[model samples]
Target: MDFGSSLGPIRPRRSGRLGDTVVTYLVDRIVSADYPVDSALPTEPELCEEFGVSRTVVRESIKLLEEKGLVRATPGRGTRVLEPPGWNLLDPIVLEAQIRHDRELKILDDLISVRAALESDMAAATARTIKAPQQQELADQLDVLADLLDDAGAYAAEDVAFHELIMVASGNRLGHAIIHSIHSKARLSSRYNGTPTRADQEQSMAEHRQIEALIRAGDADGVAVLMRTHIVGSWNRRRPEVHRSLTALPTVE
Candidate 1:
């Protein structure tokens, strides 16, 4: 309700503009259901006074929220928050908000499924076309993973890099973008859970090693199978209570 201290006077910044800060605050509130669907946002005058900004900044922020399908503005009726289905989940801002605060864990499940499908094809493509230098790059990442077995946080970071390299090398720019987006957002959430045990880390490393070997051998089928297995396996190891079969993942043509 109070945006005074929260969305205070926007200082001069090169990166996050004044409008962006307000947009982020409003998106967070909407995603958190603090502004439930059909609920009216604070009036323009109220927001201007609360954030110590002119009507221009407040109006721009509200416009942005509307563009992201988060709200509907009417002349007589104030801006009304919309339902989740109306939101643009693929939009980076909205996705980050969901990842940072969604408690239902549904977003995490969707992320895993998407990653599994895309990485399977990426792995296949990488295996078929990867050059020696890229292969070495992947090998180097594996070495880093092995060395960081004792450090979960560092290991997880390198692990993402390892896969990111493959996605890049696969020559699928769009796929890489989507996967990277998911990774960047997940890293900020509880969903990016890393291996917690020495044994678990060892298993993850083994899977990466196998995938690397398949790529070196140019075994596309093997690469696809192992990549999906590794992805799903990692998820299971991290959250044993949650099990979702990856068998339904379509094979890369």
Candidate 2:
């Protein structure tokens, strides 16, 4: 393995969780795609050395990694990265970093564009394949958003749920992965953007209702358009206003 890129520091979190150190470093390498798909993974002993953790800790770390569909371990072959199918792109932790820490988003150009595309495709795929019961699940999420206008955390949670339910209902693996992958981003963006005014709240809820309806009706194209518009328009509309408010000086003439 190449070590040209900085390995930086690997400290076990104070939480004293058994595998935190190994987990953290492995996460970085995996997300960085240093552990290419289908490639054999470093031995648990190797990770133990790099992380200075016990063998048991490394075992636990590998277990979690495998659970996330990142790797497969055989008796003799050792652990290896799974092909594209094994990866759960929609994993919340993964999406959180992608959305919040993505430096490219500083300009809000192409990064936002990637998010927009993800939403569009996700909604469309959900609309195409979501079944009756799943549509009901999506509707319940809409009800939550409608009733709870003040609880930002609750609202955000439901928002992620809505997308997850829709993605599952749509019955598309990749679409499910996309929504899962960006699930945290959708929530974080909502939280940072915070509770909107009554007017904005109504408009947002109505938009969600519209998407839900389209999915129930199996209108893939329409749901796709509505979801994309809502996501892009949100960042476009709010971020600028936020920037101006933060940067502007208050003056009394």
Name model 2 segments beyond 4 Å from true. 1-104, 107-111, 185-195, 240-253
Estimate the TM-score for candidate 2: 0.54
Worst 10 residues of 2 by lDDT: 244-253
Query: For model 1, how does the per-residue alpha-carbon lDDT over 175-253 read when each residue is reduced to its tens digit?
Result: 9998887778777655458447888888989989999999999999999999998998788677524335322211111
Question: How displaced is residue 222 in candidate 1, in Å?
Answer: 2.0
Tens-place lDDT digits, model 2, residues 14-131: 4347475456556556654567777787897777776667788888888877877778889888888876555554565444433443333442444457667877787888777777
lDDT (CA) per prediction: 0.82, 0.65
Best by lDDT: 1
Candidate 2 Cα deviation (angstroms), residue 170: 1.5
| Candidate 1 deviant stretches above 4 angstroms | 5-16, 240-253
Candidate 1 local Cα displacement, residue 115, angstroms: 1.0
Task: Give candidate 2's root-mean-square deviation (CA, Å).
Answer: 10.1
